[model samples]
Target: MIHILYDRKPMLPERHKGKLMDNLIGNNLMQRSKKHFSMNRKLPRIPINRRFIAYVGDDFHFVWVLDFNYRYVTLQTTKNHHQLNLLFDAENRVFLDCRLVKTLDEKSRKGSIYLYEIINFEDALECPLSWTRTKSNKFLRKKPRNSYPVKLTG
Candidate 1:
């Protein structure tokens, strides 16, 4: 099951973390758990943390590392077709626009899970737990209450 948390947090003081945790965490947790059953049998043991670390590349591209049976799924989004194709060629994964990625009605408006295609990579090359990090001033900060909705493809 994948937990989803999408919101642009303006630059705030450290105290905001506690407030975020106390409030936004519970709303989506129940839904993610319920929808997870719709995906697969023999449900994988998911960690309870709400935040996921993602790597944001040039343009609006972003990818996250997911623990799926110890295998990793790379999820990303791009702003335009050109950028998306460039990313697809570079990453060699099935690419999908964020527009096509569906989310529950209750999802936040911060970002959408668009189209997704599968890509194969050698485990020897990619670290199992390595998450994408934002290089910009806004980090893909994983707060205690932060999480990303999983929109995986076959």
Candidate 2:
């Protein structure tokens, strides 16, 4: 089964995963991103949902918990219209999976939004490590594969 990640309760069903993420990562980010750019540490975080609002110096704005082991955390920042992303390296204690992407904002009605859908650790690296934006552009062309194996479990 394809399980969708969330901050907590009131989880959306599998069929609504796309809408879930879209609702979770909503607009007003241009201002929120500017406020959290200098955050250097983590903090107590509430569960993520539609009404969640981020404040300045808030670590939760950028740091995302990917799993219970805390093995993966995503650091998503904004630079102008593009997003600067960094996925943590659990063993190294560093943000190694970096990316620069333009998020899809349906309300903006801008030219086709660009993004990099990071499926796994390898795809995460390939996304940002390139000198140019590879996956971001590719997403505009087509969607990337994020399906899990048949027997994988939580």
Candidate 3:
């Protein structure tokens, strides 16, 4: 006696309607569909274009930060087999201890792209010496000197 119209046509006849609904519910089709939709959802990432210094052992390498979220970051760096341990962002004065999650190869570019999961993060008031940029466009520690002359008045 009930009518279910779909696209100007009845989806199912009255006798088959209850049976189909019961079968779909009993098979957990609705729950499966919900889970499928939720599983494909991805966290939104904030896009950024910045450079960071990744330290591995005593040596360091430069990496370009492309995008990031709360727990993950995407980077582009030279082809390196060594694991990256620490990342220092000089412009932001933040340090990120991260682990590599994935690496993607670029055919058109010279370097490889990487995805990292941040294990720990810290902020600093001063930039690290190895990553600091000087006025001469070099990555060197600036000498400690007074920028202006001090006048002594007694």
Candidate 4:
């Protein structure tokens, strides 16, 4: 003998009443939660393998251009220089006024990755010759003057 059992109603609790029907009928009306949205950047970044020069204090550091956009640039270098605020591409004759936004140290490669926020961009190709002269003068004035040590005679 075989017994067949049949139930007329679902076994869900009273609090969950009509939730199944509501989900099916109102699926389109439901709005996505805030967590579903991401904090990803809106601008598309262009990947580049070009090497560029950046001025960190008195020494010029060789940095690889990993990627860039109009607002930001990502660079990689062997030396972990914290004061990397200016990126000067002599070949392109382009100057990027930037500030260090973040830094990641790669322990495996023993190198540092830097993400800089581009504050201002100046392209020599678009600017007049006079602009370059004034800009160069401004940079020169910022450099510290070399002080020669005087010979002391006893």
Candidate 5:
């Protein structure tokens, strides 16, 4: 059996699992990613969805959401120095997943930009630890998984 996660609704039917995510992205009805450069703990707004997603074609890299919301979603990445991403959505269909790439200044950290896709048919949602965002980059203060699993749900 499969299920889809959503607020105010019970588990979605199994058939709707994969198609749900595709529909959301295709219709651009779901969340959005806000990309910007952060300085002095201040987030600067820039063009959203301006960056292209890496390793998508051959490597099939994508965002596996561990948590999700209307404005932001917590997801796992497939590479090192790029563990978790905070996907911020401003306008519909325009979003950015700010991946913390490096520690730059004393107060701000550098983040890589990427296009994110929410994986459908995951598991029940649970709140994780607190995450901070400055500028356009999003990184976890705690250590994220070094490797990705074959299947990511919920």
Candidate 6:
């Protein structure tokens, strides 16, 4: 992987060292790929990048739409209980996931176990792909949660 090789380079050549630039490019590549899914279904193809149309106004804010499909449309209630459909400079800013983890709490003196799914964009992007691979649905969720309906949301 060029990205991997780039990260393992030495410093000293400083600003002109090709490795640092390579790593930056690699990091960007990984960031872009975070939301990619290996969907094999005959669905309308979406572009490679991720973006959303959002509206934000100072006057009113009631609900937000994640996406719409023939079956149903997903809506998210805004923190402020106002009613208005406003579109601001918005993009895919919400994300979610489920993961198994070990923890210690007041109830569990030794340790507690639970699915540690909740995560932010950056952390979610760096997540390993090992668990995503399965014999049945290997194509789903190959990358970070992106898009609507099937995306990761708060």
Report lDDT (CA) for all predictions.
Answer: 0.35, 0.35, 0.65, 0.64, 0.37, 0.37
lDDT of 2 by residue, 1-115 (tens): 2354454567556565456666656655555677554633343332221211122322424333221112233222232222233433333433333233444434342223233
Model 3, position 24, has a per-residue lDDT of 71
Q: Which parts of model 3 have CA positions greater than 4 angstroms off?
A: 1-43, 80-82, 89-93, 105-107, 122-154
Kindly list the per-residue Cα lDDT of model 1 for residues 1-154, writing each as its tens digit. 2333345455665565456765667767866677444455353433322233232344443443222322222233222122132122223332322222342223234333333322332332344333333346534454445466779999
lDDT of 3 by residue, 6-84 (tens): 3365565656544777887778966676645332327667676667677877888777888776467778877553457
Q: Candidate 2 regions off by >4 Å?
A: 1-91, 106-114, 117-120, 123-154
- For 32-63, candidate 5 gives per-residue lDDT tens digits of 45355554413222222232333332343444
Query: How many clashes would you count in candidate 3?
Result: 0
Worst 10 residues of 6 by lDDT: 45-54
TM-score of each: 0.25, 0.20, 0.47, 0.50, 0.19, 0.16
As a whole number from 0 to 100, the lDDT of residue 1 in candidate 3 is 21
Name the lDDT value of residue 26 in candidate 6: 94
Instruction: Point out where model 6 deviates above 4 Å.
Output: 1-56, 59-64, 69-73, 77-80, 86-154
Lowest-scoring 10 consecutive residues by lDDT in candidate 1?
80-89
lDDT of model 3 at residue 11?
60
The TM-score of predicted model 5 comes to 0.19
Best first by TM-score, ranked:
4, 3, 1, 2, 5, 6
141, model 5: CA deviation in Å? 41
lDDT score for residue 144 of model 1: 48
lDDT score for residue 45 of model 3: 73
lDDT of 6 by residue, 21-132 (tens): 8888999999998987683534332221112232334443333344322122233432322222322112433323222232212233422222122223243344443332
Residue-level error in angstroms, candidate 3, position 36: 6.2
Model 4, residue 12: distance off in Å is 6.5
Q: Among all windows of ten consecutive residues in candidate 2, which has the lowest summed lDDT?
A: 46-55
